[model samples]
Target: MAHAYVTFRIRLARHALADFIASFKSSGEIVVLVFGQVLIGLFALIAMPPMAASALPFYQSIPLLLAHGMAMSLPLFLLRRRVLPRDVVLAMHPLPIPPRIALAADALVAGILAGPLALAYIVSAAIWMSQGPEWLQADRALPATVFSFLVTCGCSSAILHLRARGPRPGPRLRRLTTLALGEPWRGPRIAYLWHRLFWLPFWRGDNVIGHQQSALLLGAIASAVAWTMAPAGIMGGVLDLTASASLILLADRGDKAVREQLGVLRPIMAAWPLQRRALEMCARAFSLAPVALLLALLFGAGLWQHTAGHVYLTLAMLAPVLLVAIPRFNPRARVGLVVASIVILTAVGSEIWN
Candidate 1:
């Protein structure tokens, strides 16, 4: 039944949340971080009206862009958000009652979407699209959303089949990890690892996905600038593209990690008896630290005129959180939390200017 998918989703969400709490070893730190996330989310919610108000012109100016933007964003969930084992998929395949009903359920769950917020976002998009008006056609968002999900499902389905034929990459990734004792560590370590693993393809001159990441980053920057310069203009399309592209970048990175690292074989990395001086970490942090900073700066880039200090503080918050806390969590969980944190921070920043 559809309830099976729903049940699985709930279980996944629970596991992630618990892991999130566990990532912060100290009880006090966990409370503090959780409180910070809650406070930020609450502020974001409070500012939603104004944020929505400001974006109204853009949304109205290009409703189709909004539709497309929302639709394309769902695929980000397919990127390493969840990877269901092949055996599990085969077992659940029979539960769809009527095959057609199962088809819709599979499209909705798509197997790889493990993040709860991602699931919620995709479902919300579906509901909104179904009810949305389409001046160009009737109900543009509905069909667009469905198509988007179908594409995502295709990708997820491919991964399921591919996985059945192969092994996870976690072990390989660990082998590539350059650990050291007393290395010069600077910047956010999470950024360091993110840069190390996620950027490896780029660094090694892999063209396809690397270019996609760059193009998406450029699109997001352009969208932000266009919106700031002319919210009522045709920037909505760019924003839509930007929204999907940036999130997809995150998803793709997660996918790559899973593909390369074989995420399952090693549950916890065996730490050496001696605490490594982390010299290597410091030396290496530079590669991704700047990149992380750039992404953080983008969220509040437009707000610098009014809330420069706040914007900087927001960026400041991101560094340590990524460096320390995020790395402790599994790859999938790391990606999910980082994305959620950015979204929450962006929301909170939106209110600061208002």
Candidate 2:
């Protein structure tokens, strides 16, 4: 039974890899993305952390590196949630595979897609952990797989549970979201209306701050951990990535409402007297309200302490936003511009912090 399970997992992973490759055959950018990511991971592994931290006691390095690895990999899995109708998609053009088994396989494949990211996290940390007190040995490989497998299983199980519910959410969900956010505006000045949009998509009865409370606590914990265990430059980059990710989640949660409103209210918006610059500012404000406040707090704290390179590090955090805001910045360009930019910027910021 155990052997069968192991084989099942490997086969599922293979299917995911094949599917990913086939899906991207018409667009070669996926190959560039994969390769660029590998290069970035390599750079991060070698470039982060101080030379002294690199030589710390084995026990000290292990805990910090382990925490760092978990911090990176676990949050990635959280973002993989999607509304795909796994059952219907697979069933439409039926593979000969049995329904019970195939759906399970699909769930596993969905999770396995994130395996490379999880693998990078641990391998990068392990390299760092090995830097201090001891050279890495070959005999400890089995234990590493067990640790990484736990994260994979957690991701797989969450996706499988979501699949078992139904084929995506229906109109009832749309109705509930409509009730939560309230009716869309007909027409209004951008500045006058922009602030309301933050908590506008929230649950109807709950206080505006209720949902943000958990995120606030998590950010606090993350900051405390980073201050203690991570270098300043790296912490800034991490916070930047975290901020970008947080905004992405915020957008994801309200995507349907945003799209629905855009569809219904386009004519109204087009008729508004707001200038192009004001509209663009409102767009940025709507997207970045939550993160902007946190960034302000961090900058304030950094200023009070006269933290060196704080300005540079703070600017580095804005780089990821370019991925979303800039339409022409293709990450998979022949020269790998975006990947190189991130690696170099992250490294230089860390060096300054160090």
Candidate 3:
């Protein structure tokens, strides 16, 4: 039973990554961009701490490296959360698998999902050790680093277990959602219904910070940076572009949800008196409001920053919007288009800066 469960989870994780990769396969540039983005992110994860610690004494670097490893637990937990759905655990509830076996399988799966990050730590530690640290000092630090990695794995496993078995919002939360949507439903019934069924859970559920809240926070931070630093260097240009891309991507979360629901409800919705285009426009207006607000914030920040990079930043930010707006273009294609725009814009901005 344990072996079977583990096999199931491994397949599940593989499928998730496969699907995400497949989403970018239409364009070679996008495929390259997706893989490159992931590789660079993981490389940064592996290299940054050791690079920072290289200048410090072995003793000092030990704490720094250990702290960085501990900090990585959050990503591990998020990886597990992404790959391992709660429904899987719920499905296993009726099985004859023992509690210990179930948890063991979960821990193993979490470790596998985060294997790249763990491998990064291992590589980082090896590089750190090569940098003229005394054998005794290295020996002492190695055990602690190993312990920290173990603890990080343990934390992710615990989070996975808890999240899978965790209590959901119950009857009261449902009642609150209905109330918020209105007793008789406000605005277009289709829009209100989507909000009640899908969006509200993320907004008012156990997770306080949903997609919209995250976007707002991101916008605030980017705006604050623009207002304060108004950074003009090549690095700043690249950062501004990255921030703009992130804002659009975050805003797309809700938009994607709406798109998915609309797809599912198309036949039923077509039966209504409203024209199909009108129905789509109404649902989209309800969904795309967050995207619009985020774009406004991003543009406002670019103007306020008033750096040489501002013009390029604004242009790059608009690329995704223009690409996604073309009739018959898949709205979901924005993810790849946004990343590609960032790369092209950053390269151009760098050359111009030079």
Of 1 and 2, the candidate ranking higher by TM-score: 2
- Give all TM-scores, in the order shown: 0.33, 0.42, 0.70
lDDT, candidate 3, residue 229? 53
Instruction: State the weakest 10-residue window (summed lDDT) of model 1.
Output: 46-55
Q: In model 3, how large is the Cα lDDT of residue 316? A: 49
**Candidate 2: residue pairs that collide:** none
Candidate RMSDs in Å, in order, are 12.4, 10.2, 5.3
Off by over 4 Å in 1: 1-155, 167-275, 278-284, 292-354
Error of 3 at 241 (Å): 2.4
Backbone clash total for model 2 is 0
Give the C-alpha lDDT of model 2: 0.46
lDDT of 3 at 25: 49
Q: What ranges in model 2 sit over 4 Å off?
A: 1-76, 83-99, 106-140, 143-151, 154-158, 167-281, 302-354
Specify the highest-TM-score model's number: 3
lDDT by residue for model 1 (1-354), tens: 446655574465346445645643432332344346654454333312222322334456255444443444344333322334435545655564554444444444444343343354455554433554333233343354344444445655444344323334465445444432234658875555545544554433212445544655566556545544445323443343343234334433433433334242133333423222252243234334334544555555555555643653455445433634334456556445544554554444344334
What ordering of candidates by TM-score runs from best to worst? Answer: 3, 2, 1
